[model samples]
Target chain A: MPYSVVGIGTSWGGLAAMRKLLSDLPADFSLPVVVVQHRGKDSDQLLTELLQDATDLTVCEVEDKDPLMPGRVHVAPANYHILIEAGHLSLTIEEPVRFSRPSIDVMLSSAADTYGKGAIGVVLTGANEDGARGLADIVKLGGRALVQDPRTAEIPIMPDAAVKAVPSAEVLPLEALAPRLVALSHEREKAGARRAV
Target chain B: MAVPVAAVPSTGAEPDRQSFKPDLERIEIELLLEGIFRHYGFDFRAYAYASIRRRLWKRIEEEGLSSVSALQERVLHDPEMMEKLLLDLSINVTSMFRDPGFYQTFREHVVPLLRTYPFIRLWHAGCSTGEEVYSMAILLREEGLYDRSRIYATDINEVVLQRAKAGIFPLERMQEYTDNYMRAGGKRSFSEYYTAKYGGALFDQSLTKNVVFSQHNLVTDRSFSEFNVILCRNVLIYFDKTLQSKVHGLFYDSLAMFGVLGLGSKETLRFMAHEECYQQIAPPEKIFRKVR
Candidate 1:
């Protein structure tokens, strides 16, 4: 099935990783990418501006009910939990889970629940294990789970935990992740075209 | 409104059952909401669909139920279940001096405007548990306007409204609140406003002396009074576009000329019908003054 959304979660050392991954994706990349990166509650819009400079695709900090559209990267605002809906995003100030607002587990679980087999969950480098359960949820719902190989991660604890939670997840190096996503985006389209003949 | 358990029609030969399930789930949710509205006086039929759906599923999983329809049956028949569900839906996450920058902006820009008036009437709509209301009271007190200002703090849930009236908060959060206070340009030590009692930080009862705490449903209720300032931060985010427009109209009608309005940091008056009527006062702060 064609994936509808890509939910990414990261924490410490995430900025560099996210910059690399997002910078690599082409301008016309078909899937809508939503990211949850743990940051200080008072952090400014520097992240969005920096990402916008790095990628050709439009990058924005999500508001209350922003639509999930292609050719855009949506970053969760600080101090709110971002939940995935059918074709849009909703935010809540619900108390943080595991002492983390903008919790990866909450976002990924919502994506899994909403998109089912059409969701793609990616867990990158981080010091905490916030995204493991979320990645597991995505896998349980027949969605794809991708984790950075611990050996290639800036901080391996997060990816290590995710690997433990969902061993069947595709583990790629830091440099390989963006390419894999690009290939996945086109794989379905290529298949559809083939069947049409 | 009594929907049978087997109301979800079985899809026969759909090639994409995955896609069909969400549509069926949407129908089940609608029926459940309609039943809740008919059985209970509370109306949530116009809430933001995505947020409400997430909250419903949270309650469903907590109760060990599989579907919205199952939860709806219990909610309609059992008053206790409805109370729990109501709390889940209405309890908003808030903090004292949340988005301190917004409060700072209010002090700098809105305070001067308030000084020109003889008396200030402020409304804190959807004041969850009273943190922001207390925060406002303290700000006014520091500003030397507390004597003439009356705050009407209202919420849809009576449970939270009572808590807001009590003026007690978890002591563990005092440190964070103090930091927020300092950032919001508080003039005095934050600890001076509250005493440690009742297993929490009990705020000075005098803070709420001029404040009226009451239960008011923004969704179904009409505006009760005109005000100089209307603070409905983050409350409209729970509403869909149609409901949001309706509430905006209510606020517009309720505010006197040149009244100030404050919203959550991420919220905007961009597409509302009254967008042109209000001029944004603080750049990027979502504070607006009724101009037209």
Candidate 2:
């Protein structure tokens, strides 16, 4: 199946990491990328704007029931837990999990549940263990689990936890992620075409 | 609404001690919600399951329970635990002048409609600690409509209602709210609305002179009165499709002809049964006017 969705979770040094990741993706990258970056409850739209400036793709903050469209980057708003349902996103005000709203685990697990084998979950540099279990869920559901190589990460706790949770996950240097995602998307597209024929 | 459960196998080498079953958990959650509703009369049975599950787990961890079934036991036997779970289940994420565009558009478009009314009744459903309610009061005051407007702010939880009635917010948020106020087309300094003291910015009490704060559950309560405008932003995102439709019906019944309905920027009246009954007043902001 074509990789239907990409869910990214990052924190600590996420602003720079996300800037680089989003900057690397081409303008026509054919997958919806949903990001959950941990930040203060009071954090403003400056982060979304900053990331948008670095990327060629359209980046928007996720709203309740916002449709998931390919070639767009959706970032979870600072204070809401973003749930991935079929073809759309939902926001909740449930109390923070592990002291964080827009929790990585919540987003990744929901994506895994919604997209199953068609989801791609990436856990990048962060200071917490939030995404580990969620990434494991993605892998369990037969989806790709990508982790930023801990050695190269600014804050390796998150990626390391992800790798530890799902040892089979591909751990790559930050520079390799965009290309790998592109290649995977192409592979999925070709497979989809073959299925169609 | 039933969320699709992915059958994810354990890929690890270790033998599974207890097989994880998503269906079992769903059953437990359903039972828990049913029990709570029957015993305590808080209807969360129709809430979106994923978020509800997360909140229940939070309560489970806090209460030292092992699973959802255990948490249900505690909830059924203990009122305090139910209160904690009630607070958890009710989503309260809010900010002053959230989605400044909504307020800005309301000021530009809906204010004119209200200007035509000699007396206005506005209902703010699920007002949640009153951030948006206060924001509306401020906006109406600036538009010279506060005196003629009676705002009814209601939430399911009484705890949040008390906090909303206080009208005191964190002083730290004042700077951020001021930015939003200015962005939403404030005519005067945002700081003029509240005085900072005791580590809080206590808003001018006179702004709420025509405002009423009460406990009203949208899932169960009947429409108390007709309204010229109803603002229920960011609240319906927690409900399933069934409840959303039902609430839309309630809003439709409550609104007078040409009255406005403002939802969070993320919400829409599309896919709703009442979609054709209202016309989109502001496209970017989810403000609609009932035309039929």
Candidate 3:
């Protein structure tokens, strides 16, 4: 709650991109991170278990009416949307977006509604441009937005679209993302104070 | 940020537009939103472009333009056209007593918490033309809480803000609004609240005595006031989810402790970091009270 709420969207090769961000944040550091990785509907394998192994931050699949906590990462589950309202979180099997559940755009826009500048959007290696405009909204509300360097990304379309939609975003390579994440987390704490002012 | 007109062939050629040329179109929107922000200060750089694209393309089709690039040129030259486009793109379609159940539920479910507060500041975010503001005012009046409340009715579009200020609505729409008003628990006939003029009904200004209509954008703007209740409905669906959370943060910051947050029926506490901060006052209708 004190640090930034980062929303990352990656389609094809997203998990690796997020792992790069997770490995960088210190254990004591407190930022709530939410991610929307396009999930296939019929796949039974749990994404949280998969992502938890990749990050030091506790990765958990979101549930209905779950409270968003600091120092934890929430991933949208398959066949549902992740929404933040009045500070509590909700996961709904409401509708599909752009042909996928756990839509990057749905999570991103809802987060933009909730966090404003407290939200930070990161677009990782992915094939589609689902989160580009939503990430642009993050920047519009004075939140930080980052795109992984497309050239180095295993799948670049997602990051490339984000860069194209949001021209002012910070573009960094995968290796550089972790330290920047830490710095951004700190900057957000200050902004939150300013916001409360 | 203007592109060469030469790159777009002059008007009078085939109306070669089913959709935009993908590559050129993609970059143009980024530039266009930037140009608007820099020149006009109405920041739309963050809206879900897919939605904006659909809206703008509708404008392009109506005006018989070839490309979004072509539409951009006209938008730069014609402020009136831009205003119309702003209305089309930004000022949402609103009806009186929209989600009448939301209001009914607010009276039963949320008003008790409201009654506990002393003087209250309610922010009607995205109060398109003030229909909901009047609706809320009427509700508060019925509950004997009207004098204790001040409603800030805000929207990104100033044109609609003026309409909201006027408190007038098309007379033709009254029949439907009356039904909605009844659903929202209006004790008196809705016609008693407005006077007919200019083929429209100018709603009674008394309902808006405690209201302030202003210009504010959820996309490119910051929080302006601390409020006891923040009502933003049907607006977030146009945004991608990330933008939705940022807007939520602004609302969260703008809310006082134990303030109420009302979202559209479809929108709710999901995926946002502050989900624990509010308790549901009306779960099915999506009205929530900020707990944290």
Query: What TM-score does chain A of each model score against the native chain A?
Result: 0.96, 0.98, 0.90
Candidate 1 vs candidate 3, DockQ winner: 1
- Encode model 3's per-residue lDDT on B37-152: one tens digit a residue: 77677777766554566567778999999787787888878888788778777835677887678888998987888899889899999898788888899889889999999999
The parts of candidate 3 lying over 4 Å away from their true place are A1-197, B1-21
The DockQ values of the predictions, listed in order, are 0.30, 0.24, 0.02
Candidate 2, residues B1-69, lDDT tens digits: the string is 111112111111111212245557779999999999999999998877666777787789988889999
Positional deviation of A7 in candidate 2, in angstroms? Answer: 1.8
- Number of the top candidate by DockQ? 1
RMSD of each: 5.6, 5.7, 15.5
Give Cα distance to truth, residue B22, candidate 2, Å: 0.9
Ranking by DockQ: 1, 2, 3
Q: Is the docking of candidate 2 incorrect, acceptable, medium or high quality?
A: acceptable
Per-residue accuracy of model 3 over A105-184 as CA lDDT, tens digit each: 76776556555656678889888778887887777766678889999899889899999999999999988887887887
Quick one: best lDDT, which candidate?
Answer: 1
Over B187-238, each residue of candidate 1 has an lDDT whose tens digit, in order, gives: 9999999999999999999999999999999988999999999999989888
The 10-residue segment of model 2 chain A with minimum total lDDT is: A188-197
